[model samples]
Target: MSATLNPNIFRAYDIRGVAERDLTTESVVPIANSFAAMLVDAGSRDVALGRDVRASSPRIAEVFRQALSSAGLQVYDLGIVSTPMLYYGVSRFQRGGGVMITASHNPSPDNGLKLLINDVAISGDRIQEIYQGAQAGRKIVADGGAVHTTDILDTYVTELTEQACIGPRALKIAVDGGNGMSGPSITRLLDRLGIEHIDLYCDPDGDFPNHHPDPTQIDTLVDLQRTVLEHGCDLGLAFDGDGDRIGVVDEEGRVIHGDRLVIIYAREILKEVPGARIVGEVKCSDTLFSMIEKWGGDPIMSRVGHSFIKATLRENGALLAGEMSGHMFFKHRYYGFDDAVYAAMRLLEIASNVPEDAPFSTLLADVPDTVTTPEIRVDCPDISKFGVVDSVVSHFRALRPVEDIDGARIRFENGWGLVRASNTQPVLVLRFEATTDAELNAYQSEIMEVVTAAISACDDSV
Candidate 1:
């Protein structure tokens, strides 16, 4: 416990850090102890543990298992599975809690843990409690316990494939796992759907020798995009490091954002369950909401986190929810977790019913096109980023009302701009959208002016 721990590693949704630095074996003991104590308090004696194909994942997961076992918890080890598979193992095994050793879409050196208790994703203050307990080196009574290893992969894939409600239209898709854990299961799921897949970088390489596992980065998806165009594939599928988030490209080689992806899912879900509530995160296009309403479904706007969106979905009884970052949760036909492989299956099923003449992009031909900026991240210290957002919020509120749900979303007649602090990184995440390019630029400029001043003001105070 004497390892120098970086306080910033305790993120809003998970405990993330540069693996070799902040997440050293010595540093993980207290954090694991804190989680074990929390699980014990929640009456979760059986814990399922899984890891991504990161260089440090096995070591980190082993530490977690040992610590939880020391606390008299039964640890089920799901060896080298994707994040969604870990979630599946938790539900299938009926474990009271689960831990995933991964950093999601972060860089290679980064590694972290995603946690659950009582089948609920832990976030907000609960995460802070873990951090606090770890800071205090919280000690729990250690009654001896045992660890058991099992493989939930085969059962997990079978269940997902069995859930396919697809037509007989065979598909040709290019899948890029980016050397993460999604490669093995995606192939299985697609095969079960009877779709032809051109696989790329699906191998499990912790070093990420080919490219980073982040599909959102545009660069990481270059190979997939090229393959789709060259091979005349129907679509391109990409996954992040742990397979929870997804990245999609159309037959035209255009990136289909998560917001648009959810729109497609919503349209289909509403057909099955009319008036089903669907959640669109603040980052989604405004047209998504209108279309959901147009299609005889209830639309709810949400903040931008998997846990936040999941909570919103459960609270509102929403049939579906999605983020701009490629995290989609479905309560329509499967467990309400973000499983990229499952999402691909659903997308393929939707594609099956399409006419032969139509391209994948035609799925959203009904919605009007608009201009938007990709997520723009600005450097700001974790301690000061929230202060910057508060300053921006106050500055905007003085002139016109702002939507401060997750951050400051300043609305204009034609467009809106957002300024929010990243829960996982030391930065401020900003995005803007408008009916036209000129208006989009204007909104971005206006927001950046306030943001620049706010950042300076916050930095000065700090």
Candidate 2:
């Protein structure tokens, strides 16, 4: 184990870095050893491991599993599974914890891990604790634990089929897996659901030769939209590299952003669980909150991270929580983990009940929408991102009404804008949602002005 390993790999929510530069075998082995040692210290004897289609994922998982086994921890290998499947394995099989080898929506040259302790996400202080444990060389290595392989795909598919109440309807759909981990499970689930669909780039090709696995980027979804339109399919769906988040296109080949999807899902959830609590991140549309309220559900706002959303969900017993990035968590009748396949199935189920003419777009047609900017990322060094956010917060506090949920969210008369530091990247995230294009432009301009001033201050302070 080298003492020169970069501790920045252990980030706030997950372990992520460029594959060769930061996530090499040398660093990963020790990090896995450290992670296994943490589990052992917490009385965990068995763990589950899964990975996406990234080229680095297999080797990484193998090394990680070996590290866990070396620490006397049993490792159940779920070869080539989605992140949610890893979570499912941990919760369903009662494993001590789970590790998913994926960079999520990152570029192909990057890969990392999302770790769970006893089926719960380990973040915030716990992440620091893990890094500290690794730094201190505090690890337990015994001879009892072993590694084994399991095929849980059938079980995963069956559970999803039960959750999906898609009544019989002859509908054509197109799904683009982006050459990621969602293909296998998605194909299996759709088969069980008796759906007739076309699969584009369904193979688990780590090279991501088709496009980047991130469906949130409109460019990545171009093929999906084309397929849907050419085939005259009812809808088009795409999943990120790990299959935890999703992006969708309606029949008219229009992208339905995640916030609108949340609005659609909330309407359905409110029917079954009236007055139930729903959560949305600061990046989500204010229309979501108002719509949720109109549908008789209480809408709560939260920070823009999975750990934060999951914690808020558990605390409030929220039926659902959604992020603008297409991460949807449903606790209405399923686990709270973000599962894109499950979400797609739920969408299909909802679509089944609507009239043939009433497409998924109809749900959002009535919701008041403003010219919202897609999430904008500005490059800022990791060390300076938080300081920039702090300065922006201070500036906004003095300028106008602001909400300090996870960042500085400035409220305007007809809209709102947010400037927050990204938890997963060296960037500042900005979003503007307004009642009109003019207001949205104004909001975006005003907030960016504050952010620009703040960035200047950050540079001066540095």
Best by lDDT: 1
Report the alpha-carbon TM-score of model 1 versus the true structure.
Answer: 0.97
For residues 1-462, write the lDDT of model 1, one tens digit per residue: 576668777777788889999999989988999999999999888999999877899899888988899889889999999999998888767889999999877788889999999667899899999988888888677676789998988999999888888876678999999898899999988877678999999987888889888888888889999999999998999998899889999997899999999899999998889999999888788889889999999999998888899899999988899998899898887778888988988998899888887888889898889899999999999889989999999988988769898889898889789999987778999999899999999999999998998888888888
Q: What is the TM-score of each candidate against the true structure?
A: 0.97, 0.97
Residue 235, candidate 1: how far off, in angstroms? 0.7
199-221 in candidate 2: lDDT tens per residue? Answer: 99888887888998998899999
The runs of at least 3 residues in candidate 1 whose Cα sits more than 4 Å from the true structure, single-residue gaps closed, are 142-144
RMSD of 2: 1.4
For model 2 the local lDDT of residue 436 reads 80
